[model samples]
Target: MGFKNFRFQVVLRVALLVVSIFLFFRLDFKSQYVGTQLALGILIAVQTVWLIVFIERTTERLIKFLNTIKYDDFSENFSSRGEGKIFDELYQRYNEVIRKFRDVRSEKEATAQYFQSVVQHIGIGIITFKKSGEVQLINNAAKRLIQVPSLSRVDHLSAEAPELAKQLLALPAGQSTVIKLWQGKERIPVALYVVDLVLRGEDFRLASIQNIQRELEEKEMEAWQNLIRVLTHEIMNSVTPISSLAGSVAADVQDYLEAQPGEQIVLQREETEDMCMALQTIEKRSQGLVRFVHDFRSMASVPTPKKQLFEVQEMFRQLQMLFQEELLQANILFLIDCRPEGLKVLADRQLLEQVMINLIRNAIHALADQPNKTLQLDAFSDPDSRVVIQVSDNGTGIAEEAQEQIFLPFYTTKATGSGIGLSLSKQIVRAHKGTLTVSSELGKGTAFTLRF
Candidate 1:
């Protein structure tokens, strides 16, 4: 129905062509002039040419419209300009298709932008990379967290943090690992979790990175406080009573021996002596037990650090003075190094001094059996600009099993160790928002690192 005009034009052209051809054939060329016969033939040829051009014109326009769609060229606006009903409707359909395509493209772009903003603004660091280590996307959070200048590949992080880069590459999907690295003056305990991703049949891995140092410190403090509370309550309850009863028994023994006639039965010399000895042993052990368990209260009651800026060299000098006699007598070489000489730390001076003393004493004890004793005390800034103090000794290193339990209270490998020094040192560092770590291998040596 829309092609009504077109059908009429086609029928009219066919009728004219047929009539012209018939007349050309019916015309008697023999009687007619040569000029008239030539004119008829020319008319017929013109009508045929017109008809072919008319048909080709419509086909050409239709092909152009389809090409426009195939190439997603929504800018093409088909305007028939009243050519005919057929072309008018065809042009309208083309315009409608282009309009819909434009709408779909706009919607797709908007959706992409929305998600792009979301990924960029998210708090957690995100890194999307290919299996070959080529990084596809690294959000702002990731850049800041990693402190990377420009990340093109995941391996590029090796320059700044080798262990973190290695762990990220080796980590499988749904697996996570925590790495401790310093950032500026703060220590960042980064937790990395990997997820498998396949976009358009291309396999990729997404890693979520977060600084869990605060979370870890919080949890550690909570665990220590909980254990300390339990030990304090239980040990004090059991040991305090034993100590009191032992004291009362000792007094009662003396009373029994000195009792006058009728007050109590007088003990003979040997009996009195045996009872006195038994009471003294009981009293001594009970008092010792009470004091041993009372140490947990110190952990639970660690005061907030009284922070002040202090120089590491000055502190080292004082420590050297304090340990001068012990170090010389043992013939252990003590080396103190402070990079930039003015290296300073903001912390509770006395508390940190205490931690350093504990580490040095442990080093001294460890170096006792080694013939060539060397102890290094170093204070410097790490690659990340964080303050680091190290106490390393060339002595018999701790066993792997003991290393794990070294920070635990009342657990020690040394026969004379109180088992609380390392634990307390760790707590004191925690109060300063720092970490105390030990790395040792059997037959090699031991190093205690303080990172703040």
Candidate 2:
């Protein structure tokens, strides 16, 4: 009953089968009585059946073990009894291996559940997807940011914003892009950052999206309030002295006029003239200050945009008509090109037109009397489906130091400039859910780009 190895067990079963068959044939030829032959045949049949069962028992146990492993069923333990020493050892190893697998699986599931909870509760929106646009995971924040209850793919965003969907699909890993989303009447700015990763041998992109509209507005308000404080301080300093001086000068002049007859006027003619000159100077400076305040007010009080779809070509045509005479007189070659024929953008026509005019006017000033004066305007859509409008001119380029603060209120390099034009234009573009940027090289040219 006890075998040293698995091969010895198999060989013993085969030998028993061969001996039973040989005896069965011999008994058939030698048996003479009916009862005897019947008994011998019954004995041979029982032995053959026992040998088949014994040989098949190991195979059956192996099949059961494999099934348990496939099903991750760890409740059943392998028995190391009733078989030979080799089978006892094999069953013991199987039991130990199954126990190890159970422990590993439990730990893995616990770890996975922990990370899942963390991912779900994070503040920022997160989504993971394959290159084919199949969404793998989406957190609650992502659903709220996207304004969707369930998302299966990135292209689903096309229903709300076509450009946004395109950008999301084509966004490169390790890069970030800002997109504008409109919820009712409010516009939200979402910043998206993507990273490439591989999970279980499959490539995926993980993106984190966060709304930055409120933050930007807060910072902008803070900047404006600071500027207002400075403006108030400067206006008070200038106005108080001007008012006091005006009042004093008027009092002196009135006293001189009311002097008694024959009494030498307390104010000499020279002193009276000096007072008059001082009043004139104050008046001039006050008027200049008034103009400055007016410009600032204009910049601060930009109205909310009334958006409408308009063709870029039509706008360009209007620009040509508006600037043709001036460009011709100044001997500046002005060119406008709208690629893809009649590209259009959704924005406030009047506001965008004002921005373009400000940029072109600045270019004209830079190009004044400069040789080979050329101004170019281009309108087209970028690869990410954003509408881009560029104004480039070969003029006295913006100095590197000045370019950084060009969009700040009251920052100007020109003595006669109000410094609000470029800043106002920048605010207008930002309000329209766009960006305005500038690139310039010394003595080469300056180019301004508006992307929406």
Candidate 3:
């Protein structure tokens, strides 16, 4: 019998014996008193031993079940056979808990698998980082985006693209930044979205990288389209009047030539001279138009740079010679503060020289009207492993509104300027794996710095 049933039977026997003793004592039954007392004592001893054994077995089973749970054996279920009635309900509850846990574990595994699949298949780059910014996970797309080396880990992106990396790292939680990264010869524009995520009470950042090449291309096309429209308008304005004037002059000359032989020779000669002058004016205007078209086309057809190691000081000396006459005419003081020896850099010599010429010419122009005009061309090496060349002029500084658009194509502030020089120079510098940046303030001279 089960322990609970055996305990119950023992209790019933004790009760019966106690009642028999009571009856014997009350009805002068002393003769049976000794026997009844002895029987009750024996029954009490046997029941005590049985109760101790049952308690020991029950405690042992409970300890075993608890140990099973501690070892993560949630699949094991306690059997009800031979167990006390008190433990039957407890066993059933424990089994139910194990079943629920199994279901939950299965669901969790499925969820993890789904996320893994998504991360692997997605085209965009995905990276996860811990709160301390240590990389936790990166997908194939992320590797491709950064051009990660096979043997190297991307623990610090700042080392690769310092300016862009700093901007990204400074972004607050739930914020994002877009940066342009140079991969070899191409500029890849990427948008980074930083998101804060909490997992098991710990915080993390999930960075999603999206390639914005198409968007950048669209914006570039739009800019070129606008430039084209402006150029077209300007060309038509200058060409139409010249064409009409030339046609009118030709017809007038033809009519005069066909007039009667001796009709007012002096007056006809005077008229002929005036017509010839008018025709020359038309020719000059047309020639100017042709020159403008040539210059514009030349600016548009800038060639890709073929980079080589060269001395920057040599380039500067050549520029100084080329613009010596202009400098003398303007009475401008030209100063060169380049290294006494040489500053070496990897760049396209021809393109670099073009950029320098454009900058120096602009500086000369700026100082043309200044009372004490000075143009300084300086070159030095920066601590960041870059060669910096600065062109500064003490002249009428750029206006605030025009400074921003100074580098844009066909955006000249000068009344008699073509406006494509600075833009083309910037393009050339960029093509040589360098940066051409400008900073200026009204009433303060402008400075253009080339970093290589």
- Which candidate comes out best when scored by TM-score? 1
Q: Mark the 10 consecutive residues where model 3 has the least summed lDDT.
A: 147-156
lDDT of 1 by residue, 59-89 (tens): 8877887887788777888876555776788
- What are the lDDT figures for the candidates, one per model? 0.84, 0.82, 0.73
Give the Å error, residue 344, model 2.
2.6
Lowest-scoring 10 consecutive residues by lDDT in candidate 1? Answer: 180-189
User: For model 3, what is the error of residue 173's alpha carbon versus the real structure, in angstroms, after optimal superposition?
Assistant: 8.4
Instruction: Give one digit per residue, the lDDT tens place, for model 2 in 1-452.
Output: 35745667668767876775666676666546556656657877777777678668768878888888899887778886556667788899889888898899999999999988888888788999998889989998777777788889889888876766787778888899998775432346899889999989998989998988657755874587478667856876878888888888888777766774555666568897899898898889899878877877777677899999999989988988899898898999998889977799999999999998999889988899688999999999975589999999999888877876787888887888878898889888888878777778779989898888
Candidate 1, superposed: residue stretches over 4 Å from native: 1-125, 131-134, 138-191, 196-203, 210-214, 240-244, 247-266
Please name the candidate that would achieve the greatest lDDT relative to the true structure: 1
What shift in Å separates residue 321 of candidate 1 from its native position after superposition?
2.0
* Candidate 3 Cα deviation (angstroms), residue 35: 36
